[model samples]
Each structure stands twice: as structure tokens, then as C-alpha cells.
Target: MSEEKYTLETVLSVKRWAANLFSFTMTRPSAFRFTAGQFARIGIQVEGELIVRAYSIVSSPFDETLEFFSIVVPEGAFTSQLQYLKPGDQIYLEKIPYGFLTLARYQEPAPHDLWLLATGTGLAPFISMLQDFETWQKYRHIVLAYSVRTQQELAYVDRINEIQNIFGENGAEFCFLPIITRDPFAKLNHRLPKLIESGDLEQEADLKFNVESSHVMLCGNPQMVEDTKEALKCRGLIMNRRGVGNIAVENYW
Candidate 1:
């Protein structure tokens, strides 16, 4: 990892979604630039040591401010302190952005459908991608499936709905699916791998997951990323490599 000098950014706003989930915005440095799906290393000083962690940017690249979504980990060195962030708090932001989970990664056999499957805070990067006009223009359809343990943990519901409305008028069709494993009343109540294996996910989206037309991006829990990758492979999808193939993944935890 690069130990480049970090930039100090002031927190512009913070909104709590649940007891453990929140999203915050910070001042964006003039020189900092990143694609929608990239992540930045953020630091917070605790005791005397600076603790840094990678978080996906939730704001669009065109946005003046940077935003990130996080879940508070009990006794966690980084998020435990991050949960208390106020509007004026100072946070350390690395200069460079990193990650390959962008739309540019898909090449050659161009994908007609885009699938963004995420769990918990993994939904952050997809939010950024959805806000980008290029993403709407690139594909014929886009499906975003965000899974959480319960309804309360589902963050950015309003913003996501707004994005859907804004992009729905454009060329591509946008579908947002919220999967709540612990909520029986929720529309979808199963894990992602199971949903993929059983074809329930495609059924809900009214789309099929095939190697040719679909480019699936998986993020969030490590186990979910691994298992979901395998499930897609079983359906004949391959990992995105050398700017080719159908699936892309990022392990958020």
C-alpha cells in the first residue's frame, strides 16, 4: 500500500440511518479525483496512532463533496470512533483512489445488463455508479440488489429511489431490489447466493443472468462475495479479467 501524505477534510454532514449504520459527507480536495466505484483510505486518530481503513465513495465523481457509508463495528478501532462524527470533525483522506469495480472493467463481449449485488455497506460504490450518467448510457438494463439482515439496516433507501426515478426516464431500465433476510414481511427474504442459484433473483428482476448479456458486480461481506461468485460461475459466468468476462467483485469485509 502507498503511504502517501494524506489530506485533512472536514466533515460536512452526517446522517444516521440506523443504530449502527450511517453516512457522512466531507470536503473534497480540489486535486482529488476518482471513478465512481473506487475507494479511498480514510484515517482517524485514536489515542496517539492514526488508524486508516478503505471505504467506497458513495457520492458521484461530479459531486463537489465526498460521501461514505459505514456500519459501526462494536469496539472496532476505526468505525467505533467514526460513528460519532459530527459536521465539523476533521478526518484524514488519502490522496489516491483505488479499486477495479468500475464499468470500464467490462470490455470485448460487452454486457447488455448490469447487476450490482451488495450486502450492508457494500452498496456504497453502486450508489456512486448509479449517479453517473455514463452508467445509464452504457447498458440496456441495470439491477441493484441490496441485502441486509433487517429493514433498519437498509441505508440510502430514499436516495436510491430518487436515483431510480431520475434514471428511469433515461434509456436503460433500472430495477432496485431490497433483500431482507430477517424480515419476513419484506418482498425478498433470502441470501444472495440462494437467490441466484434458485433463479429467484432473476425472476424478481424480470431478467436472466447469462454469460453474454449480464455483467455482475458483487460487493460487501467476504463470504457473500465468494459464494455469490461461485453461484454465478455455476450459471456459466466468469470473472472479469483483462477487461473481459462477465463478473466483478469486491470483498468489503
Candidate 2:
């Protein structure tokens, strides 16, 4: 890691959570530049020491400013005070954004369908990807499946719904499927691998999974990612590495 420049920017908004709190878009310095789906190390200069953590870039890369999605770990040394940030308060950000979650690293030449599976705050990177025009240009159909434990855990609800409506009626082929495992009111009820194995996802969504034509991206709890990877392997999907093809994973617990 190179020496990064950090700055204090205003806190745009505060989002409350069961255990953690999320802060929305904040101001960015003129020199900050990064692609969507990347992450930056953030810190706060407080109490004669620096408390910092890494967070994913949740906003579209085309945006003029910066945006990040984060969780306030209860009793956490760094996040305890971060959760109380005011609108004009300053937050720290690393000068450089870095991560392998960007689409530029996908090995496939061309894929028919792009499947982005996420759980909890793991959906941040996918949020960045779904909003980018480049994603639409790469794949004909995009299926983003997100699963959360409870309804309150669901974030970015309105914006994702808006994106669904905007793309559904238009020529763009994109679908957003929100799955709540604990809420029976949700459209789907189960983890992604179980849904994939039982055929419920395909039947309900009217989409078929073809290894030859589909590319899968997984981000979430390590268990979900590992299990889903195994399930896909049983279906003839292999990991997409620098030289391989089809599946890519960013397991962040």
C-alpha cells in the first residue's frame, strides 16, 4: 500500500441499522479518481490516533463526487463515533481506490447473461455495477439477486426499484430480485444456491441458467459464496480467473 492522502468531507446522511449504521454520499476531493466497484481505506483523526477501515465504493463511477456504503460496528473503536457524523462533519478517505471487484477483471470475452448474487452490505459493489452503462453494453441480460435476513436490512430499496422500472420497460434487459429469507412477504424465500438448485429462481423469474452463456459474480458472506460456488461448479460453471472463464467471486464477510 502506498502512502495515501486522507481528507475530511461532510457527512451527507446517516442510515440506521439493527447493529450497524450506514452513511450515504459525501463530498470528494478534486483529485480522487476510481472506477466503480472499487474500495478505499477510510479513517477518522480522533483522540490523538487514527481509526480507519476499508469500504466499498457504492456510487456510479461517472458521478462527479464520491460515495461509500459502510457499517457501524457496535462498540467498534472506529465506527462508534463515525455513526454520529453530522451533515457538515468531515470524514476521512484514502487518495487511491483499489479492489478487484470491477468488471474490467472478468475473463470472459462475451457473456449472454450476468448474474450478480449478493447478501447484506455485500450488495454495494453490485449496486455500483448495475448503475454503470458499461454493464448494459457488456451483457444482454443482467440478473441481480440480493438476499437479506430481514426487511429492515434491505437498503437502497427505492433506487433499486426505480432502476428496475427504468430498465424493464426500455430495451435494456435487467432484473432486480430482492430475497428476504426471514420475511414471507418477499417474492422469494431462500438462499441463492438453494433457489438455483430447486429451480424456483428460474421458474419465478422466467430465466434459465446456462453455463455456456451465463457469467456469475458472487459477493457476500464467505459461506454463501463458497456454497454458491460449489453449486455452480456442479452445474458446469468454473471460476473466472485471469485466464479462466465464467464465474467470479469476492467473498467479503
Write one digit per residue (lDDT tens) for candidate 1, span 1-253.
3346798999999999999999999999989999999999999998978999999999999999999999999889999999999999999999999999999989946869999999999999999999998899889999999999998898899999898888667758998999999999888999999999999999999999988889999999999999999999999999999988998999976
Q: For every candidate structure, what is the RMSD over all alpha carbons to the true structure, in angstroms? A: 1.6, 2.4
Give me the runs in candidate 1 sitting further than 4 Å from their true place: 1-4
Q: Report the Cα lDDT for candidate 1.
A: 0.93
Q: Count the backbone clashes (under 3 Å) in each candidate.
A: 0, 1
Report how far off residue 122 is in candidate 2 (Å). Answer: 0.9
Tens-digit lDDT track of model 2 for 106-218: 66646578888898888888888877777777778888888888887788888787766654554348777889999887889799889888888777657777767777888
Alpha carbon lDDT at 31, candidate 1: 92
**What lDDT does the true structure give each of the candidates?**
0.93, 0.77
- Span of 10 residues, lowest total lDDT, candidate 2: 163-172
lDDT of 2: 0.77
